[model samples]
Target chain A: MFLRIDHVGIACHDLEAKIAFFESTFGMTVVSREVNEEQGVREAMLHVADGPNGSSYIQLLEPLSPDSPVGKFLAKRGEGVHHVAFGVPDVAEAMGELGGKGIRLLDERPRHGSMGSSIAFLHPKDVGGMLTELVQAPPPRT
Target chain B: MFLRIDHVGIACHDLEAKIAFFESTFGMTVVSREVNEEQGVREAMLHVADGPNGSSYIQLLEPLSPDSPVGKFLAKRGEGVHHVAFGVPDVAEAMGELGGKGIRLLDERPRHGSMGSSIAFLHPKDVGGMLTELVQAPPPRT
Candidate 1:
Protein backbone atom coordinates (compact mmCIF):
# COMPACT_ATOMS: atom_id res chain seq x y z
CA MET A 1 0.00 0.00 0.00
CA PHE A 2 2.91 2.30 0.70
CA LEU A 3 5.85 3.07 -1.57
CA ARG A 4 8.68 4.91 0.16
CA ILE A 5 9.18 7.93 2.37
CA ASP A 6 8.14 11.05 0.51
CA HIS A 7 9.45 13.43 3.15
CA VAL A 8 9.65 14.13 6.86
CA GLY A 9 7.83 17.24 8.07
CA ILE A 10 9.65 19.42 10.57
CA ALA A 11 7.92 22.25 12.39
CA CYS A 12 10.22 25.14 13.08
CA HIS A 13 9.99 28.51 14.76
CA ASP A 14 12.63 29.74 12.37
CA LEU A 15 12.47 27.93 9.04
CA GLU A 16 15.51 29.70 7.69
CA ALA A 17 17.65 28.62 10.63
CA LYS A 18 16.61 24.98 10.29
CA ILE A 19 17.12 25.04 6.53
CA ALA A 20 20.55 26.59 6.97
CA PHE A 21 21.52 23.98 9.55
CA PHE A 22 20.72 21.05 7.23
CA GLU A 23 22.23 22.64 4.13
CA SER A 24 25.39 23.73 5.89
CA THR A 25 25.91 20.50 7.79
CA PHE A 26 24.67 17.81 5.40
CA GLY A 27 24.83 19.53 2.00
CA MET A 28 21.12 19.06 1.53
CA THR A 29 19.90 21.33 -1.28
CA VAL A 30 16.65 23.17 -1.29
CA VAL A 31 14.46 21.66 -4.03
CA SER A 32 11.33 23.75 -3.73
CA ARG A 33 9.34 26.18 -1.60
CA GLU A 34 5.67 27.15 -1.45
CA VAL A 35 3.07 28.91 0.62
CA ASN A 36 -0.31 27.35 1.34
CA GLU A 37 -2.66 30.24 1.90
CA GLU A 38 -5.40 27.94 3.16
CA GLN A 39 -3.12 26.32 5.71
CA GLY A 40 -1.52 29.66 6.47
CA VAL A 41 2.13 28.64 6.22
CA ARG A 42 5.10 28.23 3.93
CA GLU A 43 7.22 25.15 3.29
CA ALA A 44 10.62 24.39 1.82
CA MET A 45 12.00 21.05 0.69
CA LEU A 46 15.59 19.92 0.80
CA HIS A 47 16.56 16.82 -1.14
CA VAL A 48 19.34 14.76 0.32
CA ALA A 49 22.45 14.47 -1.79
CA ASP A 50 23.07 10.82 -2.72
CA GLY A 51 20.05 9.93 -0.65
CA PRO A 52 19.03 6.34 -0.07
CA ASN A 53 17.75 4.45 -3.09
CA GLY A 54 17.40 7.67 -5.11
CA SER A 55 14.48 9.01 -3.04
CA SER A 56 14.37 11.21 0.05
CA TYR A 57 13.36 14.76 0.98
CA ILE A 58 13.29 16.95 4.05
CA GLN A 59 10.42 19.40 4.49
CA LEU A 60 10.79 22.57 6.55
CA LEU A 61 7.53 24.23 7.53
CA GLU A 62 6.73 27.60 9.14
CA PRO A 63 3.34 28.91 10.09
CA LEU A 64 2.28 32.14 8.42
CA SER A 65 -0.51 32.66 10.92
CA PRO A 66 -0.23 32.38 14.67
CA ASP A 67 -3.30 30.14 14.94
CA SER A 68 -2.30 27.62 12.29
CA PRO A 69 -1.54 24.00 13.12
CA VAL A 70 2.19 24.42 12.52
CA GLY A 71 2.13 27.51 14.69
CA LYS A 72 0.61 25.63 17.61
CA PHE A 73 2.98 22.72 17.12
CA LEU A 74 6.00 25.02 17.19
CA ALA A 75 4.72 26.81 20.27
CA LYS A 76 4.20 23.59 22.19
CA ARG A 77 6.90 21.24 20.96
CA GLY A 78 9.48 23.68 19.63
CA GLU A 79 11.35 22.69 16.47
CA GLY A 80 11.11 18.98 15.72
CA VAL A 81 9.64 16.39 13.44
CA HIS A 82 5.98 17.09 12.90
CA HIS A 83 5.12 13.90 11.00
CA VAL A 84 6.47 11.11 8.81
CA ALA A 85 5.07 10.70 5.34
CA PHE A 86 4.94 7.40 3.47
CA GLY A 87 4.68 7.37 -0.30
CA VAL A 88 1.64 5.50 -1.41
CA PRO A 89 1.11 4.18 -4.92
CA ASP A 90 -2.41 5.48 -4.92
CA VAL A 91 -3.68 7.91 -2.36
CA ALA A 92 -7.39 7.21 -2.92
CA GLU A 93 -6.96 3.47 -2.65
CA ALA A 94 -4.89 3.72 0.50
CA MET A 95 -7.33 6.12 2.08
CA GLY A 96 -10.22 3.81 1.24
CA GLU A 97 -8.52 0.84 2.85
CA LEU A 98 -7.69 2.83 5.95
CA GLY A 99 -11.20 4.18 6.14
CA GLY A 100 -12.51 0.64 6.30
CA LYS A 101 -10.43 0.04 9.40
CA GLY A 102 -12.04 2.94 11.26
CA ILE A 103 -8.96 5.10 10.81
CA ARG A 104 -9.62 8.82 10.89
CA LEU A 105 -8.73 10.64 7.70
CA LEU A 106 -7.40 14.18 7.78
CA ASP A 107 -8.11 14.63 4.07
CA GLU A 108 -11.09 13.01 2.42
CA ARG A 109 -9.30 13.28 -0.91
CA PRO A 110 -5.83 13.76 -2.22
CA ARG A 111 -4.50 17.30 -1.88
CA HIS A 112 -1.49 19.16 -3.12
CA GLY A 113 1.74 18.77 -1.19
CA SER A 114 5.20 20.16 -1.52
CA MET A 115 6.81 19.63 -4.93
CA GLY A 116 3.58 18.78 -6.76
CA SER A 117 2.87 15.57 -4.88
CA SER A 118 -0.62 14.59 -3.83
CA ILE A 119 -1.02 13.88 -0.14
CA ALA A 120 -3.52 12.93 2.52
CA PHE A 121 -3.05 12.96 6.26
CA LEU A 122 -4.11 10.28 8.72
CA HIS A 123 -4.79 11.15 12.31
CA PRO A 124 -2.11 9.83 14.65
CA LYS A 125 -4.71 8.65 17.15
CA ASP A 126 -5.64 5.80 14.80
CA VAL A 127 -2.07 4.94 13.77
CA GLY A 128 -0.64 3.85 17.07
CA GLY A 129 0.75 7.07 18.58
CA MET A 130 2.80 8.22 15.60
CA LEU A 131 1.48 10.78 13.16
CA THR A 132 1.55 9.40 9.61
CA GLU A 133 0.88 10.92 6.18
CA LEU A 134 0.03 9.18 2.91
CA VAL A 135 1.53 10.65 -0.26
CA GLN A 136 1.05 9.73 -3.91
CA ALA A 137 3.36 11.04 -6.58
CA PRO A 138 1.84 12.51 -9.67
CA PRO A 139 1.75 10.12 -12.57
CA PRO A 140 4.73 10.26 -14.82
CA ARG A 141 4.34 11.95 -18.16
CA THR A 142 3.71 9.62 -21.04
CA MET B 1 26.68 9.42 2.33
CA PHE B 2 23.41 7.84 3.35
CA LEU B 3 22.20 4.77 1.45
CA ARG B 4 18.68 4.28 2.69
CA ILE B 5 16.46 4.26 5.73
CA ASP B 6 17.51 1.54 8.14
CA HIS B 7 14.54 1.86 10.47
CA VAL B 8 12.36 4.19 12.44
CA GLY B 9 12.53 3.44 16.16
CA ILE B 10 9.32 3.70 18.13
CA ALA B 11 9.39 3.55 21.91
CA CYS B 12 6.53 1.46 23.19
CA HIS B 13 5.16 0.52 26.60
CA ASP B 14 3.54 -2.65 25.17
CA LEU B 15 6.00 -3.82 22.59
CA GLU B 16 3.96 -6.83 21.70
CA ALA B 17 0.78 -4.88 21.09
CA LYS B 18 2.50 -2.29 18.95
CA ILE B 19 4.31 -4.99 17.01
CA ALA B 20 1.02 -6.73 16.46
CA PHE B 21 -0.58 -3.56 15.14
CA PHE B 22 1.94 -3.12 12.34
CA GLU B 23 1.96 -6.81 11.53
CA SER B 24 -1.81 -7.12 11.28
CA THR B 25 -2.38 -3.77 9.62
CA PHE B 26 0.46 -3.80 7.12
CA GLY B 27 1.47 -7.46 6.94
CA MET B 28 4.93 -6.55 8.17
CA THR B 29 7.33 -9.38 8.90
CA VAL B 30 10.00 -9.44 11.54
CA VAL B 31 13.39 -9.79 9.91
CA SER B 32 15.36 -9.57 13.16
CA ARG B 33 15.01 -9.24 16.92
CA GLU B 34 17.51 -8.55 19.69
CA VAL B 35 18.18 -7.24 23.16
CA ASN B 36 20.75 -4.50 23.65
CA GLU B 37 21.77 -4.77 27.27
CA GLU B 38 23.52 -1.40 27.18
CA GLN B 39 20.38 0.31 25.97
CA GLY B 40 18.33 -1.92 28.26
CA VAL B 41 15.66 -2.98 25.79
CA ARG B 42 14.43 -5.81 23.61
CA GLU B 43 13.67 -4.86 20.02
CA ALA B 44 11.40 -6.28 17.29
CA MET B 45 11.68 -5.12 13.69
CA LEU B 46 8.88 -5.02 11.13
CA HIS B 47 10.00 -4.89 7.54
CA VAL B 48 8.26 -2.31 5.34
CA ALA B 49 7.02 -3.54 1.99
CA ASP B 50 8.13 -2.01 -1.34
CA GLY B 51 10.70 0.24 0.22
CA PRO B 52 12.45 2.88 -1.82
CA ASN B 53 15.45 1.39 -3.67
CA GLY B 54 15.84 -1.06 -0.75
CA SER B 55 14.15 -2.45 2.36
CA SER B 56 12.90 -0.33 5.26
CA TYR B 57 12.14 -1.52 8.77
CA ILE B 58 10.15 -0.34 11.75
CA GLN B 59 11.83 -1.08 15.06
CA LEU B 60 9.61 -1.53 18.11
CA LEU B 61 11.59 -1.19 21.31
CA GLU B 62 10.44 -2.12 24.82
CA PRO B 63 12.43 -1.32 27.90
CA LEU B 64 14.07 -4.27 29.62
CA SER B 65 14.17 -2.56 33.05
CA PRO B 66 12.32 0.41 34.48
CA ASP B 67 15.52 2.43 34.59
CA SER B 68 16.28 1.91 30.90
CA PRO B 69 16.45 4.73 28.33
CA VAL B 70 13.43 3.35 26.54
CA GLY B 71 11.51 3.40 29.78
CA LYS B 72 12.48 6.97 30.45
CA PHE B 73 11.48 7.94 26.90
CA LEU B 74 8.09 6.35 27.34
CA ALA B 75 7.55 8.14 30.62
CA LYS B 76 8.37 11.45 29.04
CA ARG B 77 6.85 11.22 25.54
CA GLY B 78 4.48 8.30 25.68
CA GLU B 79 4.49 5.96 22.64
CA GLY B 80 5.80 7.36 19.36
CA VAL B 81 8.80 7.72 17.12
CA HIS B 82 11.96 7.88 19.21
CA HIS B 83 14.44 8.34 16.37
CA VAL B 84 15.06 8.02 12.64
CA ALA B 85 18.02 6.00 11.40
CA PHE B 86 19.56 6.45 7.97
CA GLY B 87 21.93 3.95 6.42
CA VAL B 88 25.18 5.71 5.76
CA PRO B 89 28.21 4.66 3.74
CA ASP B 90 30.63 5.50 6.54
CA VAL B 91 29.39 5.81 10.07
CA ALA B 92 32.68 7.22 11.29
CA GLU B 93 32.90 9.87 8.60
CA ALA B 94 29.33 10.98 9.17
CA MET B 95 29.82 11.19 12.92
CA GLY B 96 33.03 13.14 12.52
CA GLU B 97 31.38 15.69 10.24
CA LEU B 98 28.43 16.04 12.59
CA GLY B 99 30.75 16.31 15.58
CA GLY B 100 32.65 19.09 13.83
CA LYS B 101 29.42 21.04 13.88
CA GLY B 102 29.28 20.64 17.67
CA ILE B 103 26.47 18.15 17.41
CA ARG B 104 26.11 16.23 20.68
CA LEU B 105 26.53 12.54 19.94
CA LEU B 106 24.93 9.89 22.06
CA ASP B 107 27.69 7.44 21.16
CA GLU B 108 31.25 8.64 20.69
CA ARG B 109 31.97 5.71 18.40
CA PRO B 110 30.10 3.37 16.13
CA ARG B 111 28.28 0.71 18.15
CA HIS B 112 26.73 -2.55 17.05
CA GLY B 113 23.16 -2.28 15.88
CA SER B 114 20.69 -4.94 14.83
CA MET B 115 21.59 -7.03 11.74
CA GLY B 116 25.28 -6.32 12.26
CA SER B 117 25.02 -2.69 11.17
CA SER B 118 27.34 -0.18 12.86
CA ILE B 119 25.40 2.75 14.33
CA ALA B 120 25.85 6.06 16.15
CA PHE B 121 23.27 8.35 17.72
CA LEU B 122 22.94 12.15 17.78
CA HIS B 123 21.31 13.93 20.66
CA PRO B 124 17.99 15.65 19.90
CA LYS B 125 19.23 18.85 21.50
CA ASP B 126 21.80 19.21 18.76
CA VAL B 127 19.53 18.17 15.89
CA GLY B 128 16.57 20.50 16.19
CA GLY B 129 14.76 18.33 18.77
CA MET B 130 14.48 15.07 16.77
CA LEU B 131 16.77 12.22 17.66
CA THR B 132 18.81 11.04 14.68
CA GLU B 133 20.84 7.88 14.14
CA LEU B 134 23.48 7.15 11.54
CA VAL B 135 24.06 3.54 10.49
CA GLN B 136 26.60 1.92 8.20
CA ALA B 137 26.45 -1.61 6.88
CA PRO B 138 29.48 -3.81 7.44
CA PRO B 139 32.04 -3.76 4.64
CA PRO B 140 31.33 -6.15 1.81
CA ARG B 141 32.97 -9.57 1.94
CA THR B 142 36.14 -9.95 -0.11
Candidate 2:
Protein backbone atom coordinates (compact mmCIF):
# COMPACT_ATOMS: atom_id res chain seq x y z
CA MET A 1 0.00 0.00 0.00
CA PHE A 2 1.11 3.56 -0.71
CA LEU A 3 1.42 6.13 2.01
CA ARG A 4 1.33 9.32 -0.01
CA ILE A 5 2.43 10.97 -3.22
CA ASP A 6 6.19 10.88 -3.49
CA HIS A 7 6.65 13.16 -6.47
CA VAL A 8 5.49 14.12 -9.93
CA GLY A 9 7.96 13.67 -12.79
CA ILE A 10 7.94 16.31 -15.48
CA ALA A 11 9.83 15.98 -18.72
CA CYS A 12 11.37 19.14 -20.05
CA HIS A 13 13.33 20.28 -23.09
CA ASP A 14 15.17 22.98 -21.12
CA LEU A 15 15.75 21.94 -17.54
CA GLU A 16 16.86 25.32 -16.28
CA ALA A 17 13.99 27.15 -17.89
CA LYS A 18 11.46 24.69 -16.57
CA ILE A 19 12.99 24.83 -13.10
CA ALA A 20 12.79 28.59 -13.05
CA PHE A 21 9.18 28.50 -14.21
CA PHE A 22 8.09 26.31 -11.28
CA GLU A 23 10.26 28.12 -8.77
CA SER A 24 8.96 31.54 -9.74
CA THR A 25 5.37 30.47 -10.17
CA PHE A 26 4.96 28.16 -7.19
CA GLY A 27 7.88 29.16 -4.95
CA MET A 28 9.39 25.70 -5.11
CA THR A 29 12.90 25.17 -3.74
CA VAL A 30 15.53 22.85 -5.09
CA VAL A 31 16.16 19.94 -2.76
CA SER A 32 18.68 17.94 -4.79
CA ARG A 33 20.08 17.29 -8.25
CA GLU A 34 21.54 14.26 -10.00
CA VAL A 35 22.65 12.96 -13.37
CA ASN A 36 21.53 9.37 -13.90
CA GLU A 37 23.45 7.97 -16.84
CA GLU A 38 21.61 4.69 -16.90
CA GLN A 39 18.24 6.39 -17.13
CA GLY A 40 19.73 9.01 -19.46
CA VAL A 41 18.39 11.89 -17.40
CA ARG A 42 19.72 14.90 -15.52
CA GLU A 43 17.18 15.57 -12.80
CA ALA A 44 16.52 18.21 -10.18
CA MET A 45 14.14 17.78 -7.29
CA LEU A 46 12.16 20.78 -6.09
CA HIS A 47 10.31 20.79 -2.80
CA VAL A 48 6.82 22.21 -2.75
CA ALA A 49 5.97 24.34 0.24
CA ASP A 50 2.99 23.12 2.28
CA GLY A 51 2.77 20.05 0.06
CA PRO A 52 0.37 17.19 0.68
CA ASN A 53 2.66 15.11 2.79
CA GLY A 54 5.54 16.21 4.98
CA SER A 55 7.44 16.55 1.69
CA SER A 56 6.36 16.73 -1.94
CA TYR A 57 8.80 16.94 -4.81
CA ILE A 58 8.65 18.16 -8.34
CA GLN A 59 11.11 16.11 -10.34
CA LEU A 60 12.35 17.95 -13.40
CA LEU A 61 13.98 15.60 -15.88
CA GLU A 62 16.00 16.46 -18.96
CA PRO A 63 17.40 13.99 -21.42
CA LEU A 64 21.08 13.30 -20.88
CA SER A 65 21.50 11.59 -24.24
CA PRO A 66 19.65 11.29 -27.53
CA ASP A 67 18.54 7.77 -26.75
CA SER A 68 17.65 8.22 -23.10
CA PRO A 69 14.19 7.53 -21.71
CA VAL A 70 13.62 11.22 -21.05
CA GLY A 71 14.79 12.00 -24.57
CA LYS A 72 12.33 9.55 -26.09
CA PHE A 73 9.55 10.92 -23.88
CA LEU A 74 10.23 14.46 -24.96
CA ALA A 75 10.47 13.43 -28.58
CA LYS A 76 7.07 11.77 -28.51
CA ARG A 77 5.13 13.83 -25.97
CA GLY A 78 7.07 17.07 -26.28
CA GLU A 79 7.09 18.25 -22.65
CA GLY A 80 4.74 16.87 -20.02
CA VAL A 81 4.35 14.71 -16.96
CA HIS A 82 6.37 11.52 -17.30
CA HIS A 83 5.00 9.65 -14.31
CA VAL A 84 3.55 9.82 -10.81
CA ALA A 85 5.45 8.37 -7.91
CA PHE A 86 3.90 6.74 -4.86
CA GLY A 87 5.64 6.46 -1.53
CA VAL A 88 5.78 2.89 -0.35
CA PRO A 89 7.09 1.66 2.95
CA ASP A 90 9.22 -0.94 1.22
CA VAL A 91 10.08 -0.99 -2.43
CA ALA A 92 10.90 -4.69 -2.51
CA GLU A 93 7.66 -5.65 -0.81
CA ALA A 94 5.63 -3.38 -3.03
CA MET A 95 7.31 -4.73 -6.15
CA GLY A 96 6.69 -8.29 -5.06
CA GLU A 97 3.04 -7.64 -4.36
CA LEU A 98 2.51 -5.92 -7.68
CA GLY A 99 4.45 -8.57 -9.57
CA GLY A 100 2.40 -11.30 -7.96
CA LYS A 101 -0.62 -9.59 -9.46
CA GLY A 102 0.81 -10.15 -12.94
CA ILE A 103 2.21 -6.66 -13.16
CA ARG A 104 5.31 -6.22 -15.31
CA LEU A 105 7.99 -4.11 -13.71
CA LEU A 106 10.37 -1.99 -15.70
CA ASP A 107 12.91 -2.35 -12.94
CA GLU A 108 13.01 -5.79 -11.39
CA ARG A 109 15.10 -4.51 -8.49
CA PRO A 110 15.32 -1.33 -6.55
CA ARG A 111 17.76 1.30 -7.75
CA HIS A 112 19.28 4.32 -6.10
CA GLY A 113 17.26 7.48 -6.58
CA SER A 114 17.63 11.07 -5.51
CA MET A 115 17.70 11.84 -1.77
CA GLY A 116 18.88 8.41 -0.76
CA SER A 117 15.70 6.59 -1.71
CA SER A 118 15.28 3.13 -3.19
CA ILE A 119 13.04 3.17 -6.24
CA ALA A 120 11.62 0.91 -8.90
CA PHE A 121 9.65 1.51 -12.05
CA LEU A 122 6.60 -0.38 -13.29
CA HIS A 123 5.97 -0.94 -16.96
CA PRO A 124 3.16 1.16 -18.37
CA LYS A 125 1.78 -1.73 -20.39
CA ASP A 126 0.83 -3.71 -17.30
CA VAL A 127 -0.50 -0.76 -15.31
CA GLY A 128 -3.35 0.14 -17.59
CA GLY A 129 -0.82 2.12 -19.63
CA MET A 130 0.27 4.35 -16.78
CA LEU A 131 3.97 4.58 -16.02
CA THR A 132 4.22 4.11 -12.27
CA GLU A 133 7.10 4.65 -9.86
CA LEU A 134 7.54 3.25 -6.39
CA VAL A 135 9.78 5.12 -3.95
CA GLN A 136 10.85 3.88 -0.57
CA ALA A 137 12.29 6.34 1.88
CA PRO A 138 15.50 5.44 3.61
CA PRO A 139 15.56 4.69 7.32
CA PRO A 140 15.52 7.69 9.60
CA ARG A 141 18.94 9.18 10.16
CA THR A 142 20.05 9.33 13.77
CA MET B 1 -2.14 31.60 -7.77
CA PHE B 2 -2.57 27.87 -7.16
CA LEU B 3 -4.12 26.95 -3.83
CA ARG B 4 -3.50 23.23 -3.98
CA ILE B 5 -3.77 20.16 -6.15
CA ASP B 6 -7.35 19.50 -7.16
CA HIS B 7 -6.85 16.26 -9.04
CA VAL B 8 -4.70 14.44 -11.54
CA GLY B 9 -6.39 13.49 -14.81
CA ILE B 10 -5.73 10.10 -16.33
CA ALA B 11 -6.85 9.34 -19.85
CA CYS B 12 -8.01 5.76 -20.34
CA HIS B 13 -9.11 3.72 -23.31
CA ASP B 14 -11.58 1.93 -21.06
CA LEU B 15 -12.80 4.15 -18.24
CA GLU B 16 -14.53 1.33 -16.45
CA ALA B 17 -11.45 -0.86 -16.32
CA LYS B 18 -9.16 1.97 -15.30
CA ILE B 19 -11.64 3.03 -12.64
CA ALA B 20 -11.72 -0.49 -11.30
CA PHE B 21 -7.96 -0.67 -11.32
CA PHE B 22 -7.45 2.37 -9.08
CA GLU B 23 -10.39 1.55 -6.85
CA SER B 24 -9.16 -1.96 -6.16
CA THR B 25 -5.53 -0.98 -5.93
CA PHE B 26 -5.77 2.16 -3.78
CA GLY B 27 -9.10 1.63 -2.02
CA MET B 28 -10.37 4.87 -3.46
CA THR B 29 -14.03 5.80 -3.33
CA VAL B 30 -15.83 7.64 -6.09
CA VAL B 31 -16.72 11.13 -4.92
CA SER B 32 -18.18 12.33 -8.16
CA ARG B 33 -18.86 11.32 -11.74
CA GLU B 34 -20.06 13.17 -14.81
CA VAL B 35 -20.15 13.24 -18.60
CA ASN B 36 -19.15 16.31 -20.56
CA GLU B 37 -20.65 15.88 -23.99
CA GLU B 38 -18.82 18.92 -25.28
CA GLN B 39 -15.50 17.42 -24.32
CA GLY B 40 -16.77 14.06 -25.53
CA VAL B 41 -15.79 12.20 -22.37
CA ARG B 42 -17.11 10.49 -19.28
CA GLU B 43 -15.25 11.21 -16.05
CA ALA B 44 -15.31 9.55 -12.65
CA MET B 45 -13.53 11.12 -9.68
CA LEU B 46 -11.95 8.93 -7.03
CA HIS B 47 -10.87 10.56 -3.81
CA VAL B 48 -7.32 9.68 -2.85
CA ALA B 49 -7.28 8.84 0.85
CA ASP B 50 -5.16 10.57 3.50
CA GLY B 51 -4.12 13.23 1.02
CA PRO B 52 -3.23 16.79 1.80
CA ASN B 53 -5.89 19.49 2.02
CA GLY B 54 -8.60 16.96 1.18
CA SER B 55 -8.03 17.95 -2.46
CA SER B 56 -6.33 14.90 -3.87
CA TYR B 57 -8.48 13.17 -6.49
CA ILE B 58 -7.95 10.69 -9.29
CA GLN B 59 -9.88 11.61 -12.40
CA LEU B 60 -10.47 8.77 -14.83
CA LEU B 61 -11.51 9.89 -18.28
CA GLU B 62 -12.82 7.85 -21.20
CA PRO B 63 -13.67 9.32 -24.55
CA LEU B 64 -17.36 9.35 -25.37
CA SER B 65 -16.64 9.53 -29.07
CA PRO B 66 -13.66 8.95 -31.29
CA ASP B 67 -13.19 12.68 -31.77
CA SER B 68 -13.06 13.54 -28.08
CA PRO B 69 -10.10 15.34 -26.54
CA VAL B 70 -9.39 12.31 -24.36
CA GLY B 71 -9.56 10.24 -27.52
CA LYS B 72 -6.81 12.35 -29.05
CA PHE B 73 -4.74 11.98 -25.86
CA LEU B 74 -5.12 8.19 -25.86
CA ALA B 75 -4.22 8.01 -29.53
CA LYS B 76 -1.06 9.98 -28.98
CA ARG B 77 0.19 8.73 -25.62
CA GLY B 78 -1.81 5.62 -24.85
CA GLU B 79 -3.50 5.43 -21.43
CA GLY B 80 -1.77 7.80 -19.00
CA VAL B 81 -2.00 10.99 -17.06
CA HIS B 82 -3.22 13.79 -19.28
CA HIS B 83 -3.27 16.87 -17.04
CA VAL B 84 -2.77 18.15 -13.48
CA ALA B 85 -5.41 20.23 -11.81
CA PHE B 86 -4.77 22.80 -9.10
CA GLY B 87 -7.25 24.38 -6.77
CA VAL B 88 -7.63 28.14 -7.01
CA PRO B 89 -9.59 30.59 -4.92
CA ASP B 90 -11.36 32.10 -7.89
CA VAL B 91 -11.27 30.68 -11.39
CA ALA B 92 -11.88 34.05 -13.09
CA GLU B 93 -9.34 35.88 -10.98
CA ALA B 94 -6.73 33.18 -11.50
CA MET B 95 -7.36 33.23 -15.25
CA GLY B 96 -7.11 37.00 -15.40
CA GLU B 97 -3.89 37.03 -13.42
CA LEU B 98 -2.28 34.25 -15.43
CA GLY B 99 -3.59 35.70 -18.69
CA GLY B 100 -2.03 39.04 -17.79
CA LYS B 101 1.26 37.18 -17.52
CA GLY B 102 0.80 35.97 -21.09
CA ILE B 103 -0.12 32.42 -20.12
CA ARG B 104 -2.09 30.61 -22.80
CA LEU B 105 -5.58 29.58 -21.70
CA LEU B 106 -6.99 26.39 -23.18
CA ASP B 107 -10.50 27.23 -22.08
CA GLU B 108 -10.49 31.03 -22.10
CA ARG B 109 -13.65 31.00 -20.00
CA PRO B 110 -14.58 29.07 -16.90
CA ARG B 111 -16.70 25.98 -17.41
CA HIS B 112 -18.61 23.70 -15.09
CA GLY B 113 -16.74 20.65 -13.83
CA SER B 114 -17.91 17.76 -11.68
CA MET B 115 -19.36 18.53 -8.26
CA GLY B 116 -20.33 22.02 -9.47
CA SER B 117 -16.80 23.38 -9.55
CA SER B 118 -15.90 26.17 -11.98
CA ILE B 119 -12.91 25.22 -14.05
CA ALA B 120 -10.55 26.52 -16.73
CA PHE B 121 -7.61 24.95 -18.49
CA LEU B 122 -4.18 26.29 -19.36
CA HIS B 123 -2.25 24.99 -22.33
CA PRO B 124 0.93 23.04 -21.72
CA LYS B 125 2.62 25.06 -24.47
CA ASP B 126 2.57 28.08 -22.19
CA VAL B 127 2.98 26.42 -18.79
CA GLY B 128 6.34 24.75 -19.06
CA GLY B 129 4.77 22.29 -21.50
CA MET B 130 2.58 20.75 -18.77
CA LEU B 131 -1.15 20.98 -19.15
CA THR B 132 -2.65 22.67 -16.06
CA GLU B 133 -6.19 22.96 -14.76
CA LEU B 134 -7.50 25.65 -12.42
CA VAL B 135 -10.55 24.87 -10.33
CA GLN B 136 -12.68 27.04 -8.04
CA ALA B 137 -14.50 25.02 -5.43
CA PRO B 138 -18.18 25.54 -4.94
CA PRO B 139 -19.46 27.40 -1.90
CA PRO B 140 -20.08 25.33 1.18
CA ARG B 141 -23.63 24.57 2.29
CA THR B 142 -25.02 26.42 5.25
Model 1: residue A26 alpha-carbon error in angstroms: 1.0
lDDT tens per residue, model 2, B9-126: 8888888888788777655678888998877889999875353444657789999977788898788777888888877889998888888777888887899887889999998888
Which residue segments of model 2 deviate by more than 4 Å? A49-53
What local distance difference test score does each model get? Answer: 0.79, 0.80
lDDT of 2 at A4: 61
Taking the tens digit of each residue's C-alpha lDDT, what string does model 2 give over A1-142?
7666667799998888888887776556788989887788889998742543435577999998768888988888788888888778789998998888777888879998878899999988776666889899888799
| Docking level of model 1 | acceptable
Q: Clashes in model 2: which pairs? A: none
DockQ of each: 0.46, 0.48
B45-115 per-residue lDDT for model 1 (tens digits): 78764433345678899999878888998888788888888777789999998898888889989999877
Interface RMSD of each: 3.3, 2.8
